[model samples]
Target: MTEILLLNGEPLHTVTPQLLRATSYAHFSSLQVRDGKVDGLDLHFERLDRSTRELFGRSLEAAQIRAVLQAGLAHTDGNASFRLTVLDTDLLLRIEPPIAPSTTPVRLQPIQHQRALPHLKHTGTFDLIYFGRRAQEAGYDDAVFHTAAGEISEASIWNICFARGPEIVFPAAPILNGIRQQVLQRGLAAYETSPVLVSELASFDAAYLTNSIDPALPVAAIGEVTYAPHPESVRTIAAAYASQAAQPI
Candidate 1:
């Protein structure tokens, strides 16, 4: 799949050195666009606007954002992984090949670290990248982050959730409230948010991770506590997410 980059609705043929030297102080949101529609489209927009306001002290124009996205999609087959990034006041859209949801379970290494501003999906990802690479080096799929107090916050680029029988529990910690997580919470009837500690992992029956790319992928293990692969729970969560109505771009 070809990757395309657009800045403020204009296609870029080349990247100048100045563009590469820009500060990494930006916030962004990513979503999978299938058939020219997105499940949590409004949520993505809201996240981008809110983060821009918080980071730059101003709000992004929704109409302008929509126009830019529309412009970018025009160059694709309407199926792609789209990312809208706000650097200061400039809007940048990156279009890449769409990713299919993963069914393979993942093993995570618990790392005691928290992001600086956990709420916004900002561009400062050095910590997550470093820890995730360390986890992979340690024979783990990815890194699951916990606070200094040992409360499970989130994983690298994803939010972690636990399954207790028929109920789904999201960690009530300072982390990015992911768009896919929010959509699942609203779609599911039995769910709650609470502080999840690493000590409590043994009590949960199953676990999964959520992000824009995949709605639910079974977590095989976290540290030493291993979870039996629960395909039913994964299907339930995926069904709930699939039930949501997609909005056209």
Candidate 2:
């Protein structure tokens, strides 16, 4: 929610927020800032370092990360986001945010057999990397992208969250794992997502989406998929976060 601008190692008093309160979900990077604060900064950095190694066959030393961040800080002011991106050359660099696009929580048409490469928090979905434009033209916010086997993968920006009877179910879609997913795992809550059919939307209690920037919100509807908020699970997650923050950093 804050903007820090730096032009070539010189800091600016302010930088316009390209996507403040906006949802483009196209930029390729993890969300370091959460609600005006950086979430699990150390963990994100560690993952960043590791993901580069995993995906690019290279590892960045802590010194390298610190150097880049220091360089970035010199150019940025307070409350700014740090973005790690791969340019057209596939060479990674620290840059300002990406082009923000229109975002809408779309009712998804379930697709089948889509595989996700879950980059351990680096790459975007394989489909987004491949066939996402069609989803937009179909008059849906996005596709509730599923695996070729019909297992739910995720949305363009988040892990697909489904509310069933009394719990939140997150199927094991490792290919699309991101930062928020790790946070949910650390939080004690009753949720499970098994292999499911797209037609099973009728039986879901509720649905929502999650990414690093937004933690949780009940789904309004998903192409006739609807339900009330799963209060208990929400409360459990809220309490878990409160307890987590109150602990020593």
Q: How many residue pairs clash in each candidate?
A: 0, 9
Q: What is the C-alpha lDDT of each candidate?
A: 0.88, 0.54
Error (Å) of candidate 1 at residue 2 is 1.3
Residue by residue across 1-249, what tens digits does model 2's lDDT show?
A: 244443333454553464221212222454443233455555566776666666556775556554545666544343345665532213233435422322443466565544434554434446564445666576565666676666676766667776655566776654466666656656645567576556677687667666665666455565566556567666766664565441111
| Residues 3-22, model 1: lDDT tens digits | 99998899988877766555
TM-score of 1: 0.96
Deviating ranges (above 4 Å) for candidate 1? none
RMSD to true structure for each model, in Å = 1.3, 7.0
Error of 2 at 117 (Å): 2.7
Task: State the weakest 10-residue window (summed lDDT) of model 1.
Answer: 16-25
Q: In candidate 2, residue 64 scores what lDDT? A: 54
